[model samples]
Target: MPLMNWDSSLDVGVDKMNDEHQQILSLMNHIYDAREAGRSGPDVIALVDRLGQVTIDHFRDEEAYMEQIGYAGIASHKLIHKDLLDKFTGYASDIKGSGGQVPEKFLTFLKLWLTAHIRGIDMKYSPKADLLKAG
Candidate 1:
């Protein structure tokens, strides 16, 4: 089974953002696959690092989109992003410091955060911004 699976319900009504989210989900699964396939520790760590970086890039893109659409909740949304980034930074540090084994809590947190943020927080912006919802 994949570490994480993207559901259509997680779509935030924005094509670009949804694509980014899918990429994030793919990267998450890549980490799991790497470990499952007995890839080297460094390889798994690299995947984790890439996932973190891609997440940061996605947040930047999402924030920019929010700005373009004049999203009223941008400030709060940015805070949420920052909080997640801070937590990711800490998790990355711990993973690397401990030789690349991802803690269970880290996976749990990522799963919960992505699901909640995409469905709850991300959903709020589109309707408020009057953007056309994508299928």
Candidate 2:
């Protein structure tokens, strides 16, 4: 089974954002699969690297969308993103510095953060977008 399944509730009512979210979830599953399969160090490292890049791109797109939509909580939203990014960056550095065995804690953190952010922060931006889409 995949580490994280895409819950319908995570849908933010934006096509692009939803797609990005799915991609992230997919990458998370890839990480889990790699660990479970006892994949080589370079294999897991490549997956992690791709995940980081995808996350960066997604955040940029989401933040830009928030700005375009005039979301009032944009500042706080950006702050949340920044904090998560910093955490991931630290984990990535550690993985690279070490022999590429990702700490289980890092996977746990990603799972928790992604779910929480989607249900909380991402949902905050969803209502207005839904309203706009409906009207």
Candidate 3:
């Protein structure tokens, strides 16, 4: 099972946001491991649910930070967050309906989404914030 490693590059220069991101990554790894081990059921479903909740909470914190710092892309960032939440919610519902048997497709999707989203969208906001702090 491929694990999501927390790297400095994933940091958005916001301590709280970065910490939350780390937690999300950790939970993703846990879920991935459980899925790979064929341990599907309430255990996996509970992990997915927890990940979804953490994701929502992290997004909220990030949005609030964007507002505080007058981030120019706040609207687009929020849209991305909403889209992610929708996708996560759909995945959770599907797992619950399936009695917690998550398909391999879902695992692949989660890995790809987390990797790409953090590297792309999250990193985009980091430099500016870092610069602000440096100054």
Candidate 4:
């Protein structure tokens, strides 16, 4: 089974951000599947590293979009992103140090954080934009 399934609830109402979230979800599943298949350490490590990069890119884009849309929480959102990235960096570093074998706890953290951040945190932005519409 996938580590995390994307539901409509995770939709942040921005197409680009939604797509990026999907990509992140997919990568999370890939890691889960790799573990199930008993994939090698180096391979899993590579995937983890790629996921990290993609996350960084996505966060940058998301933050920029938040700014452009005048999301009220942009400042706090940026801080949250930084804090999450720091946490993720620590987890990724641990996995790499252990030769790429991702632990169950990290996967658990991944699920919890992504779901909460997207639904609880990210869900805040879209409605604001909708409220501020020109039309």
TM, every model: 0.88, 0.91, 0.88, 0.91
Model 2 clashing-pair count: 0
Which model is ahead, 1 or 4, in terms of TM-score?
Answer: 4
Name the lDDT of candidate 4.
Answer: 0.87
Error of 4 at 89 (Å): 0.7
lDDT of each: 0.84, 0.88, 0.83, 0.87
Pairs that clash in candidate 4? none
Estimate the Cα RMSD of every predicted model relative to the unseen true structure.
3.0, 2.9, 2.9, 3.1
lDDT of 1 by residue, 18-131 (tens): 899999989877876766765646777888899999999999999999899888899999999999999999988888887788777887788888898898889887653345
TM-score of structure candidate 1: 0.88
lDDT of 3 by residue, 1-135 (tens): 456678776767778877888899888889888877888889999999999989988889888888887778889999998888898888899999988887878778787787788777876677555664577
Shift in Å, residue 5, candidate 4: 1.3
lDDT: worst 10-residue window of model 3 = 124-133
lDDT of 4 by residue, 40-93 (tens): 588899888888999999999998998887778899999998998999999899
Pairwise lDDT winner, candidates 1 and 3: 1
How accurate locally is residue 135 in candidate 4, as Cα lDDT from 0 to 100? 40
Best by lDDT: 2
